[model samples]
Target: MNVAFTSRTLSLSRPQLFRGIRKVQSSFATCSVLSANRAVVYTSNGDPSQVLSALTFSNLPPPPPNTVNVRFLLSPINPADINVIEGVYPAKPNPNASLSSSGKGSQDEPVFVAGNEGLAEVTNVGDGVTHLQPNDWVIMTRQQAGTWSTGMNVKPQDILKVPRSLNDVEAATITVNPPTAYNMLHDFVQLNEGDWVIQNGANGAVGQVVIQIAAAKGLKTINLIRNRNDIASLTEYLSNLGATHVVTYDELSDKSFRQRVKEWTGGKNIRLGLNCVSGKPTTLMTRLLGQNAHLVSYGAMSKEPLSLPTSLFIFKNLTCHGFWQSRWYDSKSSGEREKLVETLVGLMRAGKLKEPSHEILTIQGSEGDEEASQKIRHAIATLAKGQHGKKILLKMEETF
Candidate 1:
C-alpha cells in the first residue's frame, strides 16, 4: 500500500464547511466523508494519567429507536468523578464494545468513558422521541452515564431537558452538588422559616449550595470553615451568601464560643447540623445544638472518625444519619427526579439559587487529536491538585 500525508489549513469555518459540503454533495460524482467522534476512554482501573487516552471513531451511526444523539456542552471535574476513574468509588462505569479501536485494544477487553454529570445538546433524535428536540439542552438523569466526550448517543429516558436561561456553568453542575444540598436539607429534618442550621465545610461546593438554598427558604445558617490566612475575606464571602454567623474552627474550639452562639441565635434552638468534616470541630458543633436535633453526615474531608460525647446522644436525644445523593436517585422514581429538577431550576430562574464559583477549561476540536488529548490531560492534572478552590469545568465543544 502507498500512503501520502499532506497538511493544509482551510479558511472555512465549521458553518462554512458544512454549507460547502452540502452544495458540493449534489454535483460531485463520488465523495467519502466521515465525522470524527472523539472521546477519552480507559481500559483499566488506575491513575488517569497512565490509563486514559483519546479515542476517535471515523463515523457514528444514527440514533436507534427511542434514542437521541447528543453533543456534550460542558462537564465538571469533580472529585467523585476522579475517584470513579480510579476505580475506588461505590459506582463504576459499564464498559461498551462501541469503544473498541482497531489498534488500541485487545479483542476481549472493553473501555469506559470518564465523567458522571454534564450538560448536553440534542443534535438528533430517533423516531418515537417526544420530550427532546434539536438544540434542546439536557442533563444526565442517572449516575455513570459517561459524559466526558464531544458527542454520544443516549436514551431519552436517561436525560432531562434543562432550563435554557441557565448559563453554561450553572447548567453543567446542576445534577450533582446542588441536588445533594437540596435533598440533604429536606430529607433529614424538617426546617421552617427563621429556623437555624449549622454546618462545617461551609466553603465547599455542596456547602455553598446549602448556604444559598437555606437562605432562600428563609432559614438561617451558622457556617463553620477552616481558619486561613485570609479568614476575614472568607468570612465576608460566606456572610454575603446569607450565613447568619461565620466562624473558624479556631473560634469553634474556644470554650467561650458556646455563649457567643447562644447570643447569636437569640435563644432559638439550632435544630439541624450538617457535618462534612468529621473531626474535633464537628464534635464541638454537636454541643451547640438544641434538644432532639438531627446531625446529618454527607462527606468526611478530614478522614477522621467523628468523636461525640456519649451524654449528648443519651441526654439531648440527638440523632445521627448519613446521606448519599446517588442512593437517593437510585431509590426514587423518574417522575420524582423530574420534579426535583424542576424545583431546582425554578429556584435558579427566580434568582433564589446561584451556582458555585468555577473556572472553565476549553477542550475544543482542532486539526489533530493530540491537542485535544493534551488539553484533557492538563485538565485532569489541574483537578488532581484541587483546582485552587475553584470548580474545574471542561468545555468540550466550541459551537453551541
Candidate 2:
C-alpha cells in the first residue's frame, strides 16, 4: 500500500485557532453538512485481518442535548487497539453505537468500530453545551470512543478541547503514549534534577517520549533496547534525544555493566525504573535500582511474565506498580484532564515535546468500500507482523 510518512513541526503563529465558548449560548452556527461517513469496524473478536471491514453510513443528525457532532481529522492504530479487536484487552467498545445501524449488522450481531485515540473537529453542538463551538479541535476523553471513523456524535463531556496550534499528528496521537510517559515520570516518583531514570524499550514510542521529558526536567536517562543489526545508529539516535547512556540488552546482560552503570551515575541511586518488556532483563533492571526506588510497568512486549527476586524488595525497599492511561483518565475530572492537556501543550510549545515519527494511512473517501477495507486490513496485518516501526495514523476522510 502507498502511504505517506511525515513529522509535523510546531507552528506558533496560529494560537487563535483555540478560543471561544465562555458561556452557554442560545444558538451556535454549524459547518457545512456532510452527507455520508465511513468507518473501520469488526463484528466479532478475532484477528483484525479477518474480522475488520470498512463501514459506510449516513451522516449523523444533529447531536442530542449535551452532545456535539464531530468530524474526525486523524486517528491512530495502536497495539492496544489491535488487542481490543482480538478480545484480549480489558476495555470494550460500545456495541450499541448508532453507526452500527447502517444495515451492516443487527441486534443479534452488533457491529463495533475500532480506534481509541484520535483528534476531531466540532461540526455541530446540541443544546445545553457551553465549553465547545463548531470548528474547535477536541480529543476523546473516554476509552474506546470509536474514533476510527469519519464522523460521530459524542457527548461534550466525553471529549476534551485541545489547542489548534498543534498539527494533526500531534493532536491525534497525544492522548495515549505522551500522557503515559508524563504521568509515570511525575506521579509515582518525586524525581529531582540531576537524578537518574532507567527504562527498557528506550527506542519505542513511549520510551522516546520519556527520554525527552526527563531530559527537559534536567534528569538523566539510561536507555536500553534489544540488540539489533542497527544498534549503533539506534544508540546515536537516542543519544541525540538526550539519553545519558544507550545500551543494548546484550550489554545490560554483561556482568560488569552493573559497575559501569554505577560509575555513570557517580554512584548515585537510580530512583526510577520503567519497564515495558517484562522478563529476565526487567529483573536485571530492578537489581540496579536504589533503595525505595519505584518500578512502573506499562506493557509486556516480550509476553513474558515478570519474576523478580524477593531480596530486592526486602533488602532494597523497592516498590513496583502498574500504570494504565485509561485508569488515569477515569480518575480525573474534566478540569483535571484539561490541565493535563494544557501541560503537554506547553511542553510542545517550549520545544521539549514533539510529535512521534509516523506514517499516514489515508482511506480515501472516493474509494469503494471493498478497496478501503482491504487497505485497512492489510495495514493491520503488516503491523501485527512487526513490519512498521513508526506510528500508524489513520486519516478517514468524509465521503462526498
Best by lDDT: 2
lDDT of 2 by residue, 293-390 (tens): 99999999999999999999899999999999999999988888889889999988888888898999998876767888999999999999988888
lDDT score for residue 347 of model 2: 89
List the candidate 2 regions with Cα displacement exceeding 4 Å: 1-35, 100-102, 105-108
lDDT of 1 by residue, 187-264 (tens): 878899999999999999999999999999999999999888888988898888888888989888889999998888
Which residue pairs in candidate 1 collide? none
Q: Cα lDDT for residue 164, model 1?
A: 86
Steric clash count of candidate 2 = 0
CA lDDT of each prediction against the hidden true structure: 0.83, 0.88
TM-scores of the candidates are 0.88, 0.90
Off by over 4 Å in 1: 1-35, 104-107, 398-400
Give the top-scoring candidate (TM-score).
2
- In the predicted model 2, the residue pairs found to clash are none
